[model samples]
Target: MDASPLRDPTIGTGAAAGGPAPGRVVIDARALSLTFDTADGVVHALSDVDLTVREGEFVSFIGPSGCGKTTLLRVIADLERATGGSITVDGVAPAEARTQRLYGYVFQAPALLPWRNVLANVTLPLEIFGMDKASRLEHARRNLDLVNLAGFEKKFPWQLSGGMQQRASIARALSFDPKLLLMDEPFGALDEIVRDKLNEQLLKLWAETAKTVVFVTHSIPEAVFLSTKIVVMSPRPGRIIDVIDCDLPADRTLEIRETAQFLAIAHRVREGLRAGHSYDD
Candidate 1:
């Protein structure tokens, strides 16, 4: 399967801005905090954090190391339980959401199997769930097209560039069309050029699919570029310092960064981060 644009190139942008929320609170985290009972006493990874994401919205959490951005994401995904607070998805517990496969989780790496071709990699989840072979292949093909990788479906993971591989990984995540997309530093390892392109494509994908997104990242510009809301956090006890709404237009391009409005918002987010901020130079 090879991908082609489904509608007008701009078709993907409207759903992100025009549609009413899908009427689902995809993630609700109230006073979320986590602590590990280590021999050296407790290490507080997060404290008193509150966040709520409606379906089809793109939200990003940005903070310094030890500020618990990843910790919060893990808690919401139910990979780690909160030492305090609550998380609900579709009015159900995070564990229930996990068991029902109500979301897709993307880690820092592409994590594609080395031996599998792109189509095969995307089909892996279906196999695990015991989906029928014909349906599995059909779903995988549609997903590959969704990510604009139909032509590369037969290529092995190693043959593709980093950006392509990550796109394939994202395709796999979307094959089931999970309601929420949980991303932890998905673009962290790529170069600036590759990262920017991926960010644009991801925004387009989100707009088209209307999937709720909760992304964790350390980069302020990255947060500012893709998020409707930016949650900034402080270190030590790891508390959220501020939640800033981004008022930029949804039709973002690299040129948007050069605009004053974009820089201004990014600046404010940095101020919220304060001493732990990156890119002060």
Candidate 2:
């Protein structure tokens, strides 16, 4: 897969090594916490969480199941409110950011409308936003092509493969051109082969768009492969355990996974998870 878009001369993580300078902060969260009051009792999903995501960076959140990875992503998207602390998306409140359409969210499932063809599905957000038919169609076509789904426009969601449906979902997310893309395990259901292909496409897409991305995944390899930074969290009552920087080549391929640097980063991620996990739980 041509990774030319992400190619850079630098070989390591820091800007001192002549790497690209850091972009302005796109997401800033300090002492962020979320709790739920259910019929049974109080459930703390997150606590004392702090994180920052900058423009054009691929940040992944990884931990065990029920570790509040999705919850944290949702909080950033304004789908769930933080009970305490502060978070700013693009220097504004998440709710305000959502109102301004500062980010596009992709849930675990493709969540495409089964009845609508791919073109219509991709254009649905634009249609809801009161865009003209011609303009929405143009945006839909451009995004579908961006995701390599150009000719599948006439196919309904049911007619497409699972991977294709997810690609359509990604197209729908990109159609509106949001500044940040928030994905929650969008490829978790796919087999290994399909997942790797989508990961490659996602990296190329990220390189081409330069949009900030915050992804949630349980797979350590997936997190390490695609992220410039990996945030490891504790099992429920999720707290940031470790934040590992990835210094791999910008033009990295799946084969990079076998390299010493990649394995070292993956090892650190594994150690962080082990440190935070409790077998009893």
Candidate 3:
């Protein structure tokens, strides 16, 4: 949970995007492209992408193996520099906001500290920022409750199940209460059962907090269920192919995955994924 509590609440109250400002945008990207000059060749990880994420929308990125899903995420997080174009988070440069701890990023793995207890793990970011013990402790308790892990705070990472550990990681991320959350395949290693359970909790958290999330995944059904919008990308000089708005009825439950509209959205995402996979460049 490399996050600072001063940024956002453990859960926010935002109900829509374009809400933080009167007429301004929360996130904006214009003709964004990122190319890496590796010895093998110039890797065009992203190209000519124009995207906007409102203050509290949930967006997902899905595509094939080399489609630049994670790369695009990194660029927005300011972890990577785009070769061209511009990206701004919360109307500020990503680099500055990131340095200021504007949001917390959850990568593919939990990456928790084994030696630390669950509470300590969640408080790691605050510790780095020089927050005192009493303050971090109180903040950690609130986040643990947000993720439904309040009783397990004293347990070490090794003491928890995979699902629980991931939950702890999420609590760690949210303990700082960032308005924007960037996740790169955070559930990629879990079983379907565990993944589904986490999905329910994630939606609940999103509803409670109204935080903006940008998730990267290769799973069509997962993307369809969790996102208000899905951005499809293609590989080989990876570029955005389409940006589809998910018009599914809100208040989605696990059962919603089986509904007609959900499946239809899944079908559309699959078609897009297939198209991205077939492209050589």
- Tens digit of lDDT per residue, candidate 3, span 1-281? 11121124323344233333222245799999888889998988988888887656678999887889899888888888888999998878989888878788888989999999999999999898788899899988998898899899889999998888888888888877777889999999999998998988998888787677889998888888888889998888788888888877657889998889888888888887777676545
Residue 202 in candidate 2 has what lDDT?
95
> Using TM-score as the measure, which candidate wins?
2
Worst 10 residues of 2 by lDDT: 1-10
Order of models, best TM-score first: 2, 3, 1
lDDT of 2: 0.89
Instruction: Name the 10 consecutive residues with the lowest summed lDDT in model 1.
Output: 1-10
Model 1, 40-70: lDDT tens per residue? Answer: 9999998888887765568899998888899
Q: List lDDT for all candidates, in order.
A: 0.83, 0.89, 0.82
| lDDT winner, 1 or 3 | 1
Regions more than 4 Å wrong, model 3: 1-24, 279-281
TM-score of 1: 0.89
The superposed Cα distance between candidate 1 and the true structure at residue 270, in angstroms, equals: 0.6
Per-residue alpha-carbon lDDT of model 2 for 1-281, expressed as tens digits?
Answer: 12223333242233332245666678999999999999979888999999998767899999998788999999999999999999999899999999999899998999999889999999999998999999999999999999999999999999999999999999999999998999999999999999999999998899888678899999999999999899999866778999999878766689999999999999999999999997685
For all candidates, the clash counts are 4, 0, 5
Q: Which stretches of candidate 2 lie over 4 Å from their true place?
A: 1-19
Between prediction 1 and prediction 3, the one with superior TM-score is 3
